[model samples]
Target: MATVRLLTMLPLWWSLCVSSALTPVRLRTLPLWWSLYISNALTPQALLAEWQAARIKSLDVDASRYHAQVLFVDDDNARARMAESCADALAHWADAGWWIYPHSCSLTEDQALIENPRQEAILTSLGFDGTRVTAAGAALAKEDLDAYDLVICADAAVRDAVLALGEESYETSVRLLADFATVADARSRALFDGLDVALAERARSRQDGGELVVEGADAQSDRDGFDALLESTLVLTAALVVFLKDSFDASFTDSFNGLLRTHFYDERHVDARWADAEPALRRHIVTGALDPRERERLFDAHMTGLRQRLSGDGVSS
Candidate 1:
């Protein structure tokens, strides 16, 4: 009877072992869990073998993915029409499969309250949903500038106005609309062609070690600085997806740990790291007016906090 009872429990134990191996942990949470698995397992190699076996038993989806942010800037009724049409073209590209978040803004404050009815009519005729385009006369908020991955200016004046807001850093990729002209002023097709090349290049940049950082903010008088920070944090979440997707094929925890080790845990990549911790950075920066030096300090503090958490336990249980 005792031998039979012991034999009966063996199958149950085997079943549980197999079940644990079959479930693939998401790359985002894999690091902490992998560490804990190592601690409890008979050996690291043994756990790896089990994980490999589990992977063979089922398909595991890679969770690393990123979306691009694109912003269109223009001024005056004529430019607004151009911007709206351009936005519609970008939207079609987005629907086709490019991961993108696109927005349009006016360079002049006075234009923010105006609406572009003509542009709406054109967009509707193109089989585009006019409502998808924000009213033509809206201005780019100072704080919101950091949210864009690409800025398409309708003209030189609009580009200058955007750069005047301290976003000169983005000048590297900011493009002019006139660069691509058609015989019949085929604006939409030309804009789409220019954007296709531009967006493709931008996507390649992520793989080539493009630093993910918020470019700059606008100084809106009525905006609460803290609220602006919070909004900025949200904008970077999509940016983070691009970073993580490109950085690791699978297992964010392992990849991040490897990065920490190689970089010697220094704050060399504060911009990239802080971009990851924008929520906390926003909270820190909002405590006072945003000074240039304040960003470095807040990033350092945030890094310290992250190190503390990692020290106590894995990033996830």
Candidate 2:
């Protein structure tokens, strides 16, 4: 199916996570809130409410509304419980008639399923899950994120997993600065590192915010910031592809291109118009927790198209 996966990156250990480990960061919720607040677009709470509404709105009263199974990619047992509570917050979207599969990420074999062992400390310390919440039973599977219509992650961890699974440079999507305030040359570094220039300037513009005030980059606005994001992603992916193609031989090039087409071009199963079929970018920097089965399906379809093309078939443009 043409999937619109929106994942969260709550587990910072996955990649370039600057959000305080002490603070509870969620890809689908808090991190998005922070991104919007810093971007000067909406308050954290507003950002959350808006995205929830947009997602719900994406589905309607019609029983046939193509509901997206919202996935949450979190790890911390405490964080997982909190994310699930937001399930009630999902009443609106569910009433809209969409199916949501709340998901979280864990190592493929981490035997620790801490759903609510020590919730008070994590919950109180992070300021999330204001109401004490407990964890659910062991999740179906780490890779289950693919089973849904959409994936909502909570932090860079989730996004990194997406890039890693799809072979996308997932880290670049959320790599800003280790510490925005102390990073003496964040913008200069960004120029060299290929991070967003405007996002860098936003850091510079915030004179007193320091780490606390550095906004937007981490905030979540599932509706907006994605344009620049996808453009950045395409640039990076294209550059990587070109670099490999130039350095590698014809066989290697063919293999790599086949992979690219599978993820980006093959899937048109989403219930959106062509214009929205394959988004160039998205405002939300969500992640896909683990590789999805559709990953192979996409690549398989790509290979099929290539065969047809060689046979003097397949539509062009």
> Highest TM-score: which candidate?
1
Report the Cα lDDT for candidate 1.
Answer: 0.42
**lDDT at 11, model 2:** 34
Query: Model 2: runs farther than 4 Å from truth?
Result: 1-65, 92-94, 97-101, 105-108, 118-143, 169-317
Model 1: residues with Cα > 4 Å off, grouped in runs: 1-65, 77-81, 84-98, 133-136, 179-317
- Leading candidate by lDDT: 1
Error of 1 at 65 (Å): 5.5
Q: Could you tell me which 10 consecutive residues in candidate 1 have the lowest summed lDDT? A: 1-10
TM-score of each candidate? 0.35, 0.29
TM-score of 2: 0.29
lDDT of 2 by residue, 174-205 (tens): 22111111222332222222223553344234
lDDT of each: 0.42, 0.33
lDDT of model 2 at residue 224?
32
RMSD of 2: 20.5
Candidate 2 lDDT (Cα, 0 to 1): 0.33
